[model samples]
Target: NLQLLTELDFAMAKGKLSLDMKAAAPALNSEGRIVLHQARHPLIKKEDVVPIDFELGINYHSLVITGPNTGGKTVTLKTCGLLTLMAMAGLHIPARSPSEVAFFDLVLADIGDEQSIEQSLSTFSSHMKEIIAITELAGPGSLVLLDELGAGTDPSEGAALAIAILNFLNQTGAYTVATTHYSELKGYAMNTEGVENASCEFDIESLQPTYKLLIGVPGVSHAFSIAQKLGLSQDIIADARQLISEESARFEQLITAIESSQKEIDDKKSEADKLQRELQEMRRTLEQEKEKIAKEKQELLAGAEAQAAEIVNKTRRQMEEIIESLEEKRAEQRLGHRLESELRGQISEVEKELSAHRHKRSTDQQPGEIEIGERYEAIDLNIEGVAKSLPDAKGQLVLEAGQISFSVAADRLRPVGKKPKAAGRRPRAGQAAGRTAASLTTERKMHATTELMLRGMRADEAIAAIDHFLDDAVLNGISPVRLIHGKGTGVLRQVTQDYLMRDSRVDSFRMGVEGEGGDGVTVAKLKL
Candidate 1:
């Protein structure tokens, strides 16, 4: 039961982390291939983080990512390894849809600083030792990540060693990704089949890392460019560039040109996408307007046809009335029936003239008198409101819905049901929303705590109290928690500050200023 509960907790935590990181489940693969789309590191901050797309084991079983320092090479390597491990362990990973991972029998990594003081080994020695063990143990259906594969040793020897190591890993049929600054390794990746080159892009104009990964492109060092920007003399830069071998200089120049061209193409592509979206939006708006106008025109035409029919019926009724009166007068005067028949014929001609008269349909209301506080509905607007004022000179009625009042054409609105009594006022907004006392209580309890007071308590007691307080604050995801520890000798404040420094959950803390209880109080930001 305990083990089952532990597994349940782990699954829930994984779900929460995936949700917060915008991660999704990866498609597990039987083939030794892994692909990630818009993958980002969950540990890194949201704003500072960048998403990258990469694939392995498709055309190549190994990948080589080369770029300048702090250009996200190491982070990218770790993210790929960690996400694979997470997926293998039945946890979701931070990546976009269509992401996939291969189930590896074993995963090995030698990332970050691997210097060992107890073993008296240099960085290069440690890396070589680890890779040697990895080579023996790693077999088909395995994954490996090596950082600066040949670093901290002689340049030529290290590059030579890295090439041999990668070659062996390839023969073993295992997927590998390694970061390096060596130009030789970049060339090796370019020439070697199933070993593609990838780079973290940098913006030359901003002199900043874009952290975007570009596959099948070699990266440039940009050492001279950075030096020139840092006030290095032009003559010195020129001399440095001249001393380099022609082949090496040409290779670097080629990489730089590729980066520039890629950046330009990406910029143009982005601009074209924006213009396409704007054009699509305009087209949609135009279509909607066209439909609305067509419907309105059809409705007006139908109303005109109905009014013309009504005019013809009204003329026929008037003609019949005149004929009856003429018949009564003929009987009273003892005139002949022929005269009456002639009068009826005359009336028919008059009726025909009246029927032919052009009917002028009036959309105007006939002197409608609106009353205040009367409930009304606008057929065209599809809304119900209460009349706030009588019609104005333009025959427009003022209606109020909540606090908003607007003038609408009087003919558009008509009374709905009976008038609502002014004595029975509408309920408050919250009450109308069905909020109860219990709901209000729950809201108060859920409100996060913003302050904690710990005066006159011993250092240990205060520490425990503040620790619990901080845990609650983190669970509630609140920041700038104020700790009031009263100033006498400032022992409590000192202890509190010490505790905060060792606590990794606290992002930062500072003593309060003059208006904010001065040195007696401490404000700490929590990392939730």
Candidate 2:
């Protein structure tokens, strides 16, 4: 049954495996450059994918891998050697595209256990035979894999012999991968000019082998995360980490910091994009207002001109009737008679009355003139310190901006100074600043932080936006304002507290208790 299970596992692994040998394959070149583009291990399950790709430096020659048991040290060696062998054999490797390889005369592998049952040869003797075969068959183009090289011997002897064998392979200029539990071999990788160390990634969260390979870094045992995952106490994990080299700890910290910084940058970019959209919306609203005001002004001016024309026509008709009546009366009367005198006196009186009416009408028709007490249309004159007042006789007129108490006559007003040539034209005047009545009714039209909080973002995100808001709020100089975050998961509230804790400008912040909106709001006090 055990044999059957093993065979089934091997078949399944083989069936799931695939390889690519096209242009898209990782950077493997003749210059001893190792590139495994999107290369995944065939033996690893799809669910537990071990994806890794790396180029052996253009100067790469050999590598020695060292890590905890089953940490993928041996697996990495096999993957590298097997892929190379497969490529040489004209077989595709599980890479994204074509793999590059140079022709080699011999391929050798010595992985897994080999115990001689006949007792005719000892372990060391058997190992020597394999080594002799390699030294004899190896050429400049040979590729070799050695598992636990010089292991199962005295520690001092094993390390010395391993180093010697590595040196020999380096001189032979053959590609090689060797794995060992000995720490001394790692030095061989580090000190040798063309040799490097590679490792499989392990997760700090799950304490499971991510099986992801990272080149240029020696593998770590990850005894702490593993131990912790296995139900060890915190004290044990802490002690284990303490025993690790400070450099390794620092390296892990650097990786986490890099990931965190990337996320933060992405968040900030999103925020900036949102702000840009808001600004665009505000501009659109302003433009619409200007258009509406212009239409209103057109309608108003048309009505005024029509009224003025009608009045002038009516006055002319009335004057003509009076003159005709007087002429008729005079014609009927005898020459130099009493009736003629009476008719002349009546005509003279009518002429005086007409003249008075004309003078009154002219004086009353004051265009663009602003009367101090009367109501006037608020015109955004687009000039600093000036606004267009009621029209008096001459043309449009401006009153000083912010002095609603007084009005300037239209004849006294002048055109505002022009902006620089490079400046774009302001929205056409005569349109009321086009804000919808609904928009102006309330100031709380989704404060910048509100949207993020509603999206269930992290506390840190809310805090950052609030920090930005506080800076702007300081500019606005709003005092004793309520922060309406709404009743959320309490994340916003906690984040608000954290922000207030750090902000020197905030004097105090209190969550609305019971009747004051409970957790829905926070009232903040700022120092100026």
Candidate 3:
């Protein structure tokens, strides 16, 4: 009963912790592996702390973390240790879903400043004491975290000692994570198998740590930058650089180049993703337009078919009614074959008129050129006539078809016979297809101005000038003339708006938007 109650309480507490930390329950494995993604420290302020990604124990059994002091290395170490413990205790860890952890039979940690005067132990002594114990007890199914390993000691001896200690723990089959400022240890992780390096990213310009952990890369201290930012002399910085070996300097340069290239690649990838999204959206819009246009076309075709069928049915009924009436009169006239033949001719003529309405002017009747003296047939009216005056401004021609005078658009007229020969002279070959003299005159009359700019004129002068412009625009069949009035004291705008409101020629008027010269331009639409 006690065990059951304890288990229930544990589950409830884990659920609450998961909600509070915005964490997911991590995967447990017997083969000893750990992978955490976007994992935050449980104790750190959530708003301020940046979550880190960490992986170990599969191909690489250990990882070395290197960066400047106080750059969240210690926090990262603590977070990894605590989360592992939490997972082993059946508590949900502060990490993303599908985060995996190794079920360790024993967990050991040697983190933080452990200097103690009462115990008569220095920081180095405390670290060594913990390291010895970890090396002895740690084996397969064990986890260990050591912060600033071999710190508070001599530089050369400490780095060498830290490497040896890490190697021993790794051989024991215990997954180890350690933080340090040792450049030698970085080299060790690079050349050694089953070991990896990670760096907490730092901004060069801001001289601040970005707190982003990048695995599979060694970290540099940037001691010169730190010293220079703290007001150290350039000569001192130069001397410090002189102390670094050529190999180490070259390695740092290579790392810098790699990072620069990586950043450029990332930027290009982001831009490509954006362009792909825009292209997909455009494709979707085009498909929708195609569907809409197809639907409208089908509707238009259906309407045309229905209309044609109605016209044919009405024509057939009219022919039947005429036939019936003619048959009724057959007895009075004693009609026979002649009357039937006349009736057939009359119905054929009516059918021809109705059928020809659907056809355009035939190719043979359409002449390349026609003048006042030129004779042509009207395909619609079915009459041959001489072209009188050339087309008016609207392309309508006055025709005299056997003294049946009428006016028709040029499109309705078509030439019938060949060009007549001049008296005692031959005509030029090209002149037959050339346009007439009257065509030029009519084209000139059709041309008119569509825009009028009135910037410097007075309100009355501008209004007066626009009155003539609008008259010409209406005559030439041009609507929506723009009037450019300078944005002065709203006087000119008021004058134009008032004039437009009263003018019967103007169908409507509106002010322009920014690109169209807002508040300074008025667009007036003329009546049809």
The most accurate candidate by lDDT is 1
Clash pairs of candidate 3?
A: none
Please give, for residues 26-112, the per-residue lDDT of candidate 2 as tens digits: 333455555666565656665565655645535687877665676676777777776776666445577665445555567777776
Better of 2 and 3 by lDDT: 3
Which RMSD values do the candidates have, in order? 44.7, 35.9, 28.3
Off by over 4 Å in 2: 1-31, 43-48, 120-128, 228-528
Which of the predicted structures, 1 or 3, would earn the higher TM-score when compared with the native? 1
Worst 10 residues of 1 by lDDT: 358-367
Residue 132, model 3: lDDT of 89
- What TM-score would every model get versus the actual structure? 0.52, 0.40, 0.50
Model 3, range 335-373, lDDT digits (tens) per residue?
Answer: 443464355445445535443642332534445655887
| Candidate number achieving the greatest TM-score relative to the actual structure | 1
How well is each residue in 3-48 modelled by candidate 1, as lDDT tens digits?
Answer: 9999899879988888888779999997878899878887888777
Error of 2 at 112 (Å): 1.2
Question: Residue 463 error for model 2, in Å?
Answer: 99
In each prediction, how many residue pairs overlap at the backbone (N, C-alpha, C within less than 3 A)? 0, 25, 0
lDDT measured at residue 432 in model 3 versus the true structure, 0 to 100: 28
Alpha-carbon shift of residue 510 in model 3 (angstroms): 89
Give the per-residue Cα lDDT of candidate 3 at 147: 93
lDDT of the candidates, in the order given: 0.81, 0.61, 0.79
